[model samples]
Target: MKVLVTGGSGFIASWIRKELAARGHSVLVMDHQDRRQNLAPDEEFFLGDVRDATAVTEAAAHVDGIIHLAAVLGTQETISNPRPSAETNILGSLNVFEAAAQYGLPVVYAGVGNHAFRLVGTGCYTITKSAAEDLARMYNLYRDGGRITIVRPVNAYGPGQSIAKPYGTSKVRKILPALTCRALIGSPIEVYGDGTQISDCVYVEDVARAFVTALEHTAVNGPTEKPVEVGPLTSVTVNDIAAMVAGHAAAVTGRPVVDLVHLPMRPGEIPNAVVSSDTSTLQQIGMTAADFVPLAEGIRRTVDYYATQWLPGWLQGMQVSA
Candidate 1:
């Protein structure tokens, strides 16, 4: 199958592209940025914004299926600038769905698993993502012939996951990468609120594998309306995450354990104790939490990867507060 992956340059998409290539499928990446290093030999690139219908249509023209992963992610960015967030995440997703509908191609849409649990605060990111999910359902219903498979992913983290570059004045806040980077430099690991908030973090490679599984599973496009929830079943608290990173940093670089600093929680943040996903749906796709990389191992691998690949540049930028 020749697959078109939107936002193929992203962390998770890069892994997914490799997974597809390994399965002997040709991939065409459509992204605003070029990441030729992540592309396979048989893969092609189409440079454009997903918000443009013509661009999306042109990119999807020759693909057997579509995996829609493009979006302006992160809570800080979405809340700080709601307009562009809505325009890109919501409208941009509409363009993808519309183009897929036009070409009668099957689409696999990525969603947030946090929406399945109780939410707190303003939820600007959730609002736009939820809107996009609704639009996908609408397209599936109205278009009558198109197949749209939705996969709700939990906190995905691993190597290659970096903080989004600063957008103007607001600094990007991604949990794992931030903690790991700070711990490596012996800086205090900042935990928002009481540091009790829990996340069901999944390894990037596992999440990427789930995307490919969903794309191949026929039941994903069946009569079910619920999106497949994919992630590690074990939940780890923010404090636990900080401790894990500190331990790994200490072991790797002979650094002392980093201190955990409590900070005020941001708006739209929720205290998640545990994550409950549809196990039946996951089993259907031949995945389970047991298939995930262990938390400690994943953290160590991430720290090592960043230490060699990203730590120097990150240290240069470390003068900025978390």
Candidate 2:
């Protein structure tokens, strides 16, 4: 299968591209970011944004299906100024849907796991994603010769996280990267409202598999009812995440990983939110929590990545401080 992965250069999409290639799928990427070094040499990349309907349609013209992952993702940031996010998340999605419907292409849409937060109005991200999700279902009802699959991922973490992505809008100080960065630099890890808010962290690799499953199972003749929710059954507090990052870094590098400090929850953010997803679809497809990488193990790998990527600068700084 030839697939078009929007936002293909981002973290999760990187894994998706790899998964697709492993399964012998040809990949075409459409994103605002430049090509990264890790992409398969055979993968074709287009420098474009989903917001432009012409560009999206052009990219969709030659692909068999679409794995839509493009969006502006930030909790507080989206809530602060929602127009760009709205335009991208909502409008961009509309473009993908329209193109897929016209070309009769299946789409494995990457939605947000926190979509349940729509009830409490966490931010524009939830609102826009929820809206797009509804559109997916609606489009499925009448879309000709195509299907749409929605995969709601919680916190996807692994190696290669950085601030170059603006906290990675595709991120703003996304929790895992933010914590790992601060820990690497011996900077204080900020905890919001005692760090009790719950989060479900899934490995990027697992998330990628879930997407491929949806794509592989998609019926070319029509719409299928697959709203895959990828998350672990267990939960972890934000504080627990911070502690693990700090503890693991200290153990691995024999360096002071830094301390956690409490702060008020930022505006437009949900507080004390314990989120667990409905993995029924993923289970139906033979994917479950058992297959998920252990959170601690995933964190260890992520910390190792950041450490390796930034160790040189960190060592130079440490020498200066000493």
Candidate 3:
């Protein structure tokens, strides 16, 4: 199969691209920026944005299916600037759907599991993502046929994820990378609110497999049925995550301890929210929680990755080019 993956340079998309290529599928990556280093030799790349219909159409022309993953992420980033988030997540997604509809291509959309039930807060990131999911459903209903499959993934973490430069930067907001980096550098790990807000953190490789499965699955369609929830069957609180990161850091680097600093939760933050995998949907897709990487093990791998792989390359990039 020839698969077109939007935002192929992103963390999850990177894994999806590699997985598809490994499964003997030719991949065509379309992203606004060039992160060609993540691509395999058998994969092709196109510099394009999902917002541009022409670009999206050109990219989807010869692809057997589409995995739509391009969008502005981060709750803080989206809440801080809603316009661009709306433009990119909503309008940009519409362009992708329209193009896919034109080409009669099957689409596998990446959505947030949190929004699968009820949105606790009105964060722009969730709002725009939910809107895009609606657009995907609409396209499926009114277009050639219902050839869309929605995969709602929980908080996905792993190596190759983007992190703030200069190491230990406070601007790093993603939970996993932020905690991992702070623990490695002996900085206090910041936890928002009471540190009890629950999240289901799935490994990137697992999420990548779910996307590939959804793209190939012929039974997914329409918006009436619930989207397939991909993640661990259990949930962990924020405080639990902090402790896990600290423990993994200690184990990996032989550190004595790591401190947790409680901070007031930011605006648009959901309190007491928990995300869990829908077993029925997973069963339908022939997946189970046992197939996922254990949280503690995943955390340990992530800590090592940031400490060894990501941090060193970032520091090297900062060196003066003479």
Ten contiguous residues minimizing lDDT sum, candidate 2 = 162-171
- Give the per-residue lDDT of model 1 (tens digit) for 1-322: 7899999888889899989988888899989876776666777989899988889989888888888899887776677788877888899999888887787787888987776432445456768887888888887777765578888888788987756433112255677888877787788888887877776677788888888888877324542356878776676687888899888888877888889999887766755445445545677666786877888888888989878777776666656654
> Cα-based RMSD of the predictions, in order?
3.3, 2.6, 3.1
What TM-scores do the predictions have? 0.90, 0.92, 0.91
lDDT of 2 by residue, 108-132 (tens): 8888888888887688978998899
Q: Residue 276's C-alpha lDDT in candidate 3?
A: 64
Clashes of each: 0, 0, 0
Candidate 3 residue runs with Cα over 4 Å from true position = 116-119, 165-172, 219-224, 311-322
Which residues of candidate 2, in runs, are more than 4 Å off? 36-38, 164-171, 220-226, 317-322
After superposing candidate 1 on the true structure, give the runs of residues whose Cα lies further than 4 Å from its correct spot. 35-38, 116-120, 164-171, 219-225, 271-276, 312-322
Clashing pairs in 3: none
Clashing pairs in 1: none
* Cα distance off (Å), candidate 2, residue 108: 0.5
Candidate with best TM-score? 2
